[model samples]
Target chain A: MATSAKSTDISKTDFGKSPINARLSAEQKLKLLTDMVRIRCFENESVRQYSAGKMGGFLHVYNGQEAIATGCASLMGDDDHMITAYRNHGHALGVGMNMNECMAELFGKATGCSKGKGGSMHFFAPDKNYWGGHGIVGGQTPLGLGLAYALKYKGVKGAAMCFMGDGAVNQGCLYESLNMASLFNLPVIYIIENNGYSMGTSLERSSAFKSCLAERAAGFNMEWAQCAGTDIYEVRASVQVAMERAHNESRPTMLEIDTYRYYGHSTADAKHNVVGGYREREEIDFYKKNHDPINVFKAKLIAEGVLTEEQFDTLEEGIKAEAAQSAVFADESPYPEVSSITEDVYYEVDRQTEAGRTGKHFFND
Target chain B: MALIEYRDALNQAFDEELARDENVVLMGEEVAQYDGAYKVTKGLWKKWGDKRVMDTPISEAAFIGMGIGASMLGIRPVMELMFWSFATVAWDQIINNAAQVRYMSGGLINCPIVIRGPANGGTNVGATHSHTHENFLANVPGLKVVCPATAYDAKGLMKTAIRDNDPVMFMENTLLYGEKWEVPEEEYLIPLGKADVKREGTDITLIAHGRAALTALRAAEILAAEHNISAEVIDLRSIRPLDEEAILASVRKTHRAVLIEENKPFCGVGAQISSILMEKCFDDLDAPVLRISSIDAPAIYSPELERKQLPRPLDIVAKVLSIC
Candidate 1:
């Protein structure tokens, strides 16, 4: 959707000349671009496979919000944990999950990240400290608090990043976690990707605050900031500072990354019927042409002489090839054996005791 | 062996388990500074400090969900709910998340959390506060429901539930928390899915768990003294992975069977037990399996009405007489 000519311009300063220049190295800049393009490409492939009926369940695409995930995830290390909502393809890709595994998971194959047990909504990589892509709206909010609590209890130098959408913002679980997070000062960051519409409800209709989502954070005595997600630098600047404060001070921050999802909420919702026509294609195209997060980053990289048009073209082609390989790998992967139907219901990896195996399988085992 | 109250047995389990596993943390409202709403936590908070025995706000959904998350990461968390009825607020987390996460993850992760609190009536807490969730939670797969009627069983099974790798719904009755019983001083662990034959008899088998087990025991004594009926009493410690073998064995010995529970009658635990007996021991039974449960209604504030709401020993005695 093209924005009206009178619409306000947000953060037009080139990242190379702004405060981001001092904080970000050239490698980091290239990494951000690569991550964003990789996610965008992967999601595009998902739409293709889904249309072909290669995947069975719902398909939620995170096409336009690439910068929010790529920029924010770059700040954390191995010890950090992440839990996000179900529109999770981009987040999973950003946190360094194998492209093949993530795609295979959607394919319901054994090689998937969650072993095909969790389709679109549930993606877990415990080894990578990416806890899950939970199906419940705001279910991960409290769980992430517990993860952060564990980090603090162990005196580890790590924080937990919990991501949700504007739709999940109003859940009682979020409010409850916020109050508790403030009470104990747990090292956690609650990121709300305010993509304007949650399913079919717009932010203005959903939020009682009726202004900014971050303003609600003040009630919990939590530190919150609002930053545009269109430019990678803007997201990085906000998330880096938030992560630093949470890790060092044992504080919790509620960060609202203002972004937009160009696609409908899921493949189930038709693009033409986006939020019952509240969002026009012109307004959406306006951002894609003028402030598309990925294109904006690509333009910046070219302007800085980091990459020429020819080099960018080669990068795009390479990324497309990589994304295509993931789809093929997912298609070829095997489904888990039938024995796994009842396995993993409890304590699969950790065996607590063998003192008495009597009736163990019937109950605990 | 030393005589101890049901509350002390649970406290000792918390004390020993916390010492046994550093990852075994205790969290709930008033569980730390306030030493638990019912004082089941007691002085363990002082001994273990805030890290292990921590307190939380009156947020059941958040803390219960936290237990699910932490347990998935090797942290054994025994979360206490102020009351079992409060679990309704966090029902989504318990049924949808904790119970299904392991099955859904296909063995990637499992929630080893124990949601324990008082789930009994007759304290005059009225309708909203009381719940006998044995039948309710037992209905869900991927969850182990433990209802220990005695202090000895409470201590042994509390330790077992804490150490087990699966999510367990530990149901404790506040009415029996103060009852005195001889619990062994030595360390012990009672495996789940096993039931105890509290009394051996000949004429009829009485099946019950938690508070109703005590009621059945009393009813057995009354039946023995008043009538010539030698009633056998079976204490089903864990209702989910139920001791069906023991139940069938008992029913075979005693031709008649009677199931008892404090929950309402419609679609309750007895309804399932009766159906099971009909399938397994239909020919062995001399008469149809009868059940005695609380009247089908919500608990009322009035003492007389509450009394009528729950099952009394006389109800069991009459059922045994009727079957005979």
Candidate 2:
């Protein structure tokens, strides 16, 4: 593969010696490692499917940003709500969406999570408390606040985690949502995964102020934090703190996670720019070879003797097999019937019918 | 039955629905302490308290999207757009998210949200404030557009919109707010996609909606007494999922049809009705379908220009009598 020249000039963020000194037990570390690997393998297979033209539509692979989703989702219980931007395959997997359903959705099949209509950008599973994989830049922020309001209204202590990219930080709705969330003390955690670029535009080019996104939280009087998102433990700690603040004090928080995406904005972006359209190929290679979330976790677990080499090998093989089976399931699943289009739009009960009936005679003779 | 103004009937419906359904809530600019721009939400803040009747910031897109999200989470939200013109700002959420969620999810989700506001130009509110968006929303597939012309229909349709499982654009009229009518002193819900026959005759069928429907009825009365043209008048309460059956049946009896609308003639509700008539009742027609509507220019602020911009009762009367 031809490598871009900028890759040589780009400096990687220093991976500080384990941000939190707290050591997880062997079982917990193994479980986290397995989760990360499952997401990595799943998304890798998705990219393969995209390359083969089997997965149509926009394919936004979360190859390099796995740690943020895995770490954050680990803190959420079944009752809490999660909404995120279009780069959402990893988040959907983290929230426990069936692999078969996720793959089928990408394949635009009836058995998919969104019944094949949403494709990749608009997947939603309310039962899982995953509101959506919303495509509109900062549109999901207010929705997250609304979900938190509903939970508070129902006297539930569940928090809503609203995720967006660095590029969406400038949307006017984000400011409005932040104000509302703070004014009402909504239990919401607004996370911005600062991946350095919005499509082909770098954060430096698009954002006037790039260093501290969390600083904007003060304008809304929100609690704020920043962390190295490449480290699962650091990401987990930051999310846990925000979750606690939201649950205990009913205060909203903003967490800025410094992260990156290994793929181009989408599969279609040639990713070539005079000033460097895509990140240096070497930078992607470095992340994929060394700092890959799955590899880092796997290395840590194996070095700590959390699992035998044989067990890790078996886990990888099993995950690969699972991903392959899901592809088959998606391939064989049928497309939604045209007649099914009109269903589920409204809930019509007898009460509405009776009410409509009485009003009928009002206009009748 | 009691006589109440359209505005008061709407207020009563909101108050009663909020009290009856704990899941029902209200949100919009000036809906809380200011009592709504049109005062249709008056006394609701005090009765329902601040939580149920929320006053949102000026971000229409955010609040409307929030309403959609809240509805999906089992809450029935009655969102006021302040004016129907502001709905254009939130079209993305309305058209892409709310309208398509149910079908996109394959029957997994129901967007039971009501977006209600006063539409049409009559109060001389000028171009910016005055707009009739029923035609624009009717083109959307997943939405139900309701334009209620009377106090009875306003209350009934609003209640039904709140209870509906899909997103509904409940369009009211600024001029009709003070108009009084007899309404039953109980809960009622007029089903969507049903038309109401305001008057029955056999000479010509005049079909309209919202304020235009009232104009058509008035025109029907005038044509009956003066021109000796007994025109049947139909109020298409809902624009989407149009009551084509009632319309065709009326046209069959009358043999001639006149469609009236506040929207411009080009791609307006009148055009849709005309197409439906042509397809369903072409063989039974005694004459071609005549449509009365505003010109395609933006509504001018000048009083004379505004008057010329609006489709008047005289326009409906002239079209119906001419066709007869």
Candidate 3:
């Protein structure tokens, strides 16, 4: 067996300086930059549409943590699976969900990814191997192990990435999943996005561990690492190494991405006067000033001669226009048919079988 | 046709399904190496090997949710609970994920998984050990709930539940695992949501499912021979997509109905049937729709209290006579 790497606290490791084993092609790098831009632009527009009453329910924006999702998405092969918690709009865009469909879903249109059924919290693109935008906290943790189990059972090579908040690290099912994933040698990468606060509770208050969120993973005999989530290259490089261990060694790894959430927990939390605030204005300014992922990446691109200052501005405008076009597409899409509400509640039963269906319920009669 | 134990029939179904499809997997506590706590999976582990018939730790929430996830990705998993009552621990996965995944995804994904185990409240087991959660699970929109009373129904429905495209909560009765019934060796399947008229009559409809249906059959014999009343026994094998037509036809014919179940009457499966009958056929009923169910309390551990707590043949007869 490969070295168990028993919780080698990589929280302070400089993964950005780690040798880039699988360098992205020029087109792929450009795609990653555009993907991050799209998520930022789209979510910023969501705030507008939400305030304008175009959307209802919770909208947890992934504004500052764009680099984490963009980096994780880079490691995912077309066949690899990605599952995440409700703050999943960024992950959806990162994993290549249709921009128009995703926006339409936010607008509750018939043409949405979930056919207007699942709003902001639930986005699914199984065709792209994006499992779902699970609403329940830690709801999709075991599912990551399950997908890996199936892949291993079928001798498939791809890994299943399960993303959740730092809050989800305390869930009992996640512990069970970690135990089983390690026991069975399943290819599952447990990614915990540690944005400090879980809902309104700070990390100190919720988690028993005084240190990093990934420290608890040691009990499950699972290899784990932590990275500064603001740097896309760091997240990409670190997760890529973890994914390689999962693929080549058929092992499970827990990655705690030290990140921050710009907005409140949900759209409701965004109203500062109503709910007050979890963090002070100065706390917000600290991350914004030092670790703006988009700007940081832009600076890196300029230094590397990938993008000039003027070109970056033009690219930003292009992304904003793309997001605006998606919003328009969503606006044009119709609401789901009235009868569509009852549909999809169950699988279409085989009518020919006497038992599968019962004369099509009360309405049809 | 061959006479076999209810557990063996379930085992046969598992063996056959595993043989037929490579994707079909059986998982639960002590289901593989230990041959199941009830020995329902006896010797199958040796036949199928570890990969096909596997054992899992006592983490129901994790394994059950894992089964749902695996099923979504082209694997057919039959997850067994040691007791159906233990499902409360993994309630989120069963109700939230298993029941809602198909609906929330706009049918983009389907969970073809079967969760099976005994759900009756007899055999001296206390409250937590025994639970008839048919009403609770069936109430969920996306799931299909099935109960098998006889050895024949057990084999047929267990096979069907395995092959079903949606999530199926296959609730078995602990008391009836050893019951013998003749099952055909030929390939056959009993479709879900279809009620079987175990015995036909015109005087009254004795509605029941699982082991209660078997007891109802015994009560029907007593009513026929001693009381001279021809009772139609309607076994509701499928609970969720209920056989309303079959029920209505029986109620229309009998003009009287008595729901017999070993579950609580407070919003139980019997209560649902009573309401359905009242709504659909108020005029057809010769008397008020009566329900003979377990007493409104936790299942008692004391043998005498437990027996008295659940509906017996006498209770069925008494309820039937009152309706008649």
Candidate 4:
């Protein structure tokens, strides 16, 4: 099992020094970089739009933790699934959700993915096998297990990657999910994106763990690993091992990817990132300057002679233009009409079955 | 038609639906090898095997949420909560994930899961175990709540709830589980949001659900025999879709209304129905709408007190005479 090599406590490992798994073609490597750039640029533009009062609701952008979603999604098969907490822009884009629809959703437009019904924290695309951007902390944990349960129930050799933040580590339901996943031997990988902070509170102050968070999986007799989230290669290597365990053995794995986020909890809380803030300015800069996933990967690709600086610049420029184009699309899209407020509440309401047609489902009607 | 206990009627619904659909699965504590706590899922595990009828740990939130997750991917999961009162632990999963998923997804997803268990207070199970959540569940916009008072309604609604393309909260009564009533052996589905007139009269409309509907029916008989007042009993099989037209039609004809429920007096199902009657048929009513809810208190541990705490036939009769 690759669990021995991949499941070490690598929270203190150097981001750029992790052993690289050079199995991807130059095109695939470039695609990973392109996806991350698009996610970063899309969220960057979303913050600007939020500042201009063009968006509504809490906006949790995925700025620094790009490698986790991009790397895990790189290994997803057709039967594989993904679900994450509210900070899910990276995962959504990683699974090939359209930038236009995602951005329009931020603008609360009719053309958005959820038709503007779900605001910033509730993005969903079942067609893409992306379950949702669930708002509740640790609430999606069991759902992730359920998705994997469905896979095993249907005899499909696929895994569900359920992602949550460090703050969710202490939620009772997460522990309940851990026990069920192990007892049922379900094919699920519970991915903990440890960004050090859960909202304004640090992990040290929030969770009471013995060693690291993922080590708690030992209580459930499940496999666990920790990796540097800044290194996409390491992220992919660790998640690949868990996916193999799920596909071959139909087992569950708990992964703690040690990552850092550049912004506050949400764009609404950016004001708390000052010098004397809940976290320090230097801590943020240290990660951005040394461990930025994009920069570290760009340097690695250059060292491998797979990407030239000029080609990299062109790819980035194209990505920037696409992100900007999405903003323009969102700005031009119309808001959903008031009549559509009652539209998607129930499946039968839309299907108009005899039961759905029999009574007044909506009190407003 | 044949006489069967409410539990067996439910068992028949599970048996027929499992035979009818390959995707329908039943999972909960003791549902499999243990034959279910209340035996509602009796013999299902042996019939369908482990893949279909499975046993989960005593974790309500985890299993319930897991069922919701599986239902999203085309599996019709029938999650059995030992008691609807235990749903408090998994309340977020029911109200947030299962209920709101389809709406939040803009119809991109469907959570066709049924979380069913007994939710009554007269069993002397104490305050924590005894709870009627139909009122609480019906308040949510994206959920459908069903309460069956008779074996026929239990069989028919359980079938329809299984086939529904939305999340359904099915509430049963433990005291009514062993009670026998005639139910058709043939396959049939009772549409939700439609009220059943258990007894028809012209003087007053008695609106109730689940066990309270049975109480209202008994009260209707007494009102006819002793008081010489003809009362119509409306059993609200489904709470949310609410059969408001039938309620309005009955109230418009009867001219007086008395709503009864096993839920608490504050914010009960009767509260909403009373407001609906006042707003829609105020001119047609000869008197103000009345409500006979469980005494505004917790479920007592003593059997006698607990029996009186829930809505009784006398409570319905007394409330009816107040308006008559």
Best-performing candidate as measured by TM-score: 4
Q: Is the docking of candidate 1 incorrect, acceptable, medium or high quality?
A: medium
lDDT tens digits by residue: candidate 4, B1-324? 689999999999999999999999999999999999999999989989999999999899999999999999989999999999999999999999999999888899999999999999888879999988888899898899999999999999999999999999999999999999999877889999999999999999999999889999899999999999999999999998889999999999999999999899898999988888878998999998999888888889998888878888887888888878
Q: Write the per-residue lDDT of candidate 2 for residues A77-153, one digit (tens) a residue.
A: 86688989898988888888878999999988889998887888877777888877888888788788878888887
Give the winner by DockQ: 1 or 4. 4
Real contacts recovered, all predictions:
0.50, 0.43, 0.53, 0.80
Off by over 4 Å in 1: A1-8, A12-25, A271-276, A348-365
Q: List the residue pairs that clash in candidate 3.
A: none
Q: What's model 4's lDDT at A348? A: 91
Candidate no. 2 TM-score: 0.93
**TM score of chain A per candidate:** 0.92, 0.87, 0.91, 0.94
Best by lDDT: 4
As a whole number from 0 to 100, the lDDT of residue B311 in candidate 2 is: 83
Predicted candidate 1 versus true structure: per-residue lDDT over A203-231, tens digit per residue = 66777663477768899999988777888
Interface RMSD of 2: 4.6
**TM-scores of the models, in the order given:** 0.94, 0.93, 0.96, 0.97
- TM-score of B chain for each model? 0.99, 0.97, 0.99, 0.99
lDDT of candidate model 2 versus the reference: 0.80
Candidate 3, CAPRI quality class derived from DockQ: medium
Which 10-residue window of candidate 3 chain B scores lowest in summed lDDT? B101-110
Per-residue error (Å), model 2, residue A121? 1.3
- Model 1, position B124: C-alpha lDDT score: 81
Q: Interface RMSD for each candidate model? A: 2.3, 4.6, 1.7, 0.8
lDDT of 3 by residue, A134-239 (tens): 9999989988888888888898898999999988888899998998998889999999988877888777777776357786778889998877777788888889
| Residue B140's lDDT in candidate 3 | 80
